[model samples]
Target: MVDHRQRRDELIDVVWRLIVEDGLAGITIRRVAERSGWSSGAVRHYLPTREAILDAAAQRVAELIEERIKAVDASAPPLDALVAVLAAVLPTDEQIQRASLVWLAFVGQAASDAGLADAQGILYRDLNQLLVELLTMLAAMGFQVDGGPASAAVELQAMLDGLTVHVLLGRVDADAAQEVLRAAVNRLLTRPPEADG
Candidate 1:
């Protein structure tokens, strides 16, 4: 007999494939059941409502991203570790590009759905916290974070977000994106505040 948890995972996998292949509008209980070779009722047994399925999918995506970041070597320098985290978030290749597409789709959907928006808020807050921690570490490493690290971290996070969107839209290649990010990091690390005359 198949494990229930396994079945649920299969459903989530099917949902992700459907989202990647057919876009967000393609995820229905009937479609998922057909794709997963399960009955409609069986799929519903795992995810009773469309919203529930979407919520589960969003959470699964977040978990996968977190897992990828967790696998990076943290013993590296803080800037290097932060770059690893940023690279993990970028669409550097096919696998990551697909994941980025799925994430973007969910983000668009979340704009209109209150429940999804709330779920997205949680993910965003977690990512922001991670960025803040990295920036704090960089400050400890002698990087000048003028006016405190939090504001600088927020600015860096915005830059990263803009870079990811550019990568996803094919406006920037991975190498160019990396160069741009490195330049931004260097400037942030080296630029000094204007001194009074």
Candidate 2:
């Protein structure tokens, strides 16, 4: 019996591989069929268009990051867990590197593609909400967030987004990005509350 879910995942994997090798422009129904060794009709049966392929690739990256975030040690020290959550979203490893690049490509194309733009907005909202929850938890655990959890999540999200680009562009390596993220989180967690005027 064909495991439909497994087949879909394999197709998405092929999409990411193609994106890494040739950018988003490299993706096509026929190309995916070739790469996955499936018939073009079969590929179309799963994802009817190039946009669908891009959407799936972007979604897979988000899913991978969320899975990593959920797997972080809840029992670990608060700071470590926080770092692990943020780090889970970074493109620090081979798998994440490929996935992140595909996501970035999709985001870059979103500027001209309304469907992709909508998906991008939803992705940002979901990720932002996740960060807000994490920040709220840290605050409850005795960490101080400089601008409340919502604002802190925005700041952390920006830092994470920038660090991903920097890491991918060779401006900073994975270790450096991790250090930067750690420092940023530490400041957010440990900064003394502002004095009233």
Candidate 3:
């Protein structure tokens, strides 16, 4: 028997790509169906409403991040592993670039959508917690956390976001972004933070 879940997933994938490329402004059941070579009725079978399509796209983004993190080897050094996690989210390659673009749209849409906003919050919280945990581990390893683990996580996350934007704008490359990410962590582990802009 054919799996209905798989078909739904396929439809979600099509919508997800649309969001990534078009930034969530023009997505509709008819558009998604046309993109996927199906009828609007068929797309509705998977996502009955525009809201459902948006939710599925947001969910796929989270799933993609989770899958990337899960693929990292745990035996690597803590700092190296952390860099891998951060780099995975950077717009360094075609796949990651697409994900990052889709992520921007997700953030914009989340402003008014309670459900999408909540999901974005949860993802942010989880990543922030992981960074905190990593910073704590570094401190345990005798690194000087100039401020504190909690504050360092917040700062590092903000830096990462800004760096990712620069990367998308062609002002920074993947290697440069990775270097900046590592240096930010190093500075947090060593020096005091600069005054907020």
Candidate 4:
């Protein structure tokens, strides 16, 4: 018997490549089957509808990033750790670029798709919570932040989103994007905690 889970994952991967090559509009069940080296019938057994395939592809991209975030080293300095985590979402390399393509494509879909928009809202909420946690870490490390941590978190999110868009459009390369974000983070914070305090 064919492993449905394995086949489903393969189809999702094909959709990912198709998104890179053709974007969301190019992902049909037949197209996925053609690219994934499976028959349309087999692909359908895994994904009964085009929407199902898209949802699977989006879920797969989310899972990949979540796994990367979970795998970050716990012993790094607070800012270093936060940068590492945030970089997972940025298109800073080939692998991240592919994930970003899928994510940004999903984001584009969100404008017209209520379900995707809701997912984006949930993602933004989680990102906000992460920023708050990281800002608290900065406080503990003695960084003076403007407008407090909550406001800083919102500002940082906006900055990152804009940078990611610029990077995606080739207006900025990955290194430039990273450096810009790092510089922005530094500008928004100051005065690290004293050793004696």
Candidate 5:
């Protein structure tokens, strides 16, 4: 007998692949089952609705991203840690690039779909919290943030998001993106008031 967990994971994998290939519009019970070599009934047994499957896929992607960020070495300096976190978010290779494509598809689908929108909100909040934590650490390390921790966190998060979009759209290469981020961090960390004196 096939393990239910394994079967569910297979379904999610199939859904992710479909999303990468054809966006959210490409995912349906029959299509996913066909891609995974599972029966439609089996797919339905695991995910009774399209929304459920999408929510599962989104959650899985979030978990994978969190896992990647967590794998970075926390013992490094705050600047190094921040760079590592940003690097994890960027699609530097083929596997991560595919994941990024799936994420873009999910975001577009979530914009008009109320159910998926809620999941997207949760993921955004979680990611923002992670960024806030990183920003707070930077502040502790004497970074001269223009505003309070919360504001700095939001700004840095926005910058990272913009960079991700540019990189994914081919407007910026990975090396150029890294340099931009590094320059921004350097500017953020430099003590302007001290330099003025």
Candidate 6:
């Protein structure tokens, strides 16, 4: 009896390795089977199509990042918590760099693939909600924010997304990206909220 969940995770690991070696363009049913040492039929038994495989990979990426974010100390100081949460999303290590590559590829592919787009949407939405919660915590602790928590979260989310790309592009190394994120969160928390127009 196949431990279907375990087998699927094993195949996803192969997909991540392929993604690190080559971009998403490198993935195919045959390549996955060869990489996993499974017959193509067996690989198909789990992920039957290219779209199915990519969708699953995207989901795994989301799950991986969410797990990291969830592991941060929620009881820490609000400012520290904010930085930790945002930093968790950045690809600061080799493993996460691979996931980031896969994530970016699916982001582009998601434009034409409705299923992929939905997965991507859920990822963005969940991350955004987490940010909102952390930002709200800061506000509750009497930190001065430039806007409401929701608006501030949007800005932080965009900044984190851009930083992820820069790190992946080699334009910004991981250390510098982390420094920039920490500084940005500090500024956001200290900056005064905007008055109503």
Best by TM-score: 2
Residue lDDT tens for model 2, 1-197: 99998999999989888988888777899999999999999999999998888778878877888888888888776777778888888887888888778778777878998887876776688889988988887777666788999998999899998999999998998888889999998888773354120
- The residue-by-residue lDDT of candidate 1 on 45-154, one tens digit each, is 99998877887887776777787789888887556676778667677777667667777777788888788787666567777888788778777666676556677667
Kindly list the per-residue Cα lDDT of model 6 for residues 1-197, writing each as its tens digit. 86999999999999988876787778899999999999999999999998788878888988989889889997776677778888888888887888888888778778887877886786788889888887786677667777888998999999999999999999998789888888888777773354120
> Once model 3 is optimally superposed onto the true structure by TM-score, how far is the C-alpha of residue 158 displaced, in angstroms?
1.3
Q: Arrange candidates by lDDT, highest first: which order?
A: 6, 2, 3, 5, 4, 1
lDDT of the candidates, in the order given:
0.76, 0.84, 0.79, 0.77, 0.78, 0.84
Between prediction 1 and prediction 6, the one with superior lDDT is: 6
Q: What is the C-alpha RMSD of each candidate to the true structure, in Å?
A: 4.4, 3.8, 5.1, 2.9, 3.4, 4.2
lDDT of 3 at 108: 82
Mind giving the per-residue lDDT tens digits that candidate 4 earns over 1-197? 97868767767778889988887777888898788888888888889888788777777766777777787886776666766777667776777778778878878878998877765565577678888988887877788877888998898888777888889899988778777777767777775655231
Candidate 5, 128: how far from true, in Å?
Answer: 0.6
**TM-score ranking, best first:** 2, 5, 6, 1, 3, 4
TM-score attained by model 1 = 0.84
Q: Give the per-residue lDDT digits (tens) of candidate 5, residues 1-197.
A: 86988878878888888998888887788898898888889889999988888888888878877988998998876677777787787778776776677777767888798877886776677878987777776666666666766776677767877887789999999888887777776666654343321
Clashing pairs in 4: 142-192, 142-193
What is the number of backbone collisions in each predicted candidate, taken in the order shown? 0, 0, 0, 2, 0, 0
Kindly report which residue stretches of model 6 are placed more than 4 angstroms away from their true locations once superposed.
191-197
lDDT of 3 by residue, 1-197 (tens): 97999998889878868887787778899899999998899888889998788777767766777778778877776667777888777877786677777777777888997876875675677778888987887777766776889998899888888888899889998899999998876676652243111
Which pairs clash (backbone N, Cα, C closer than 3 Å) in model 6?
none
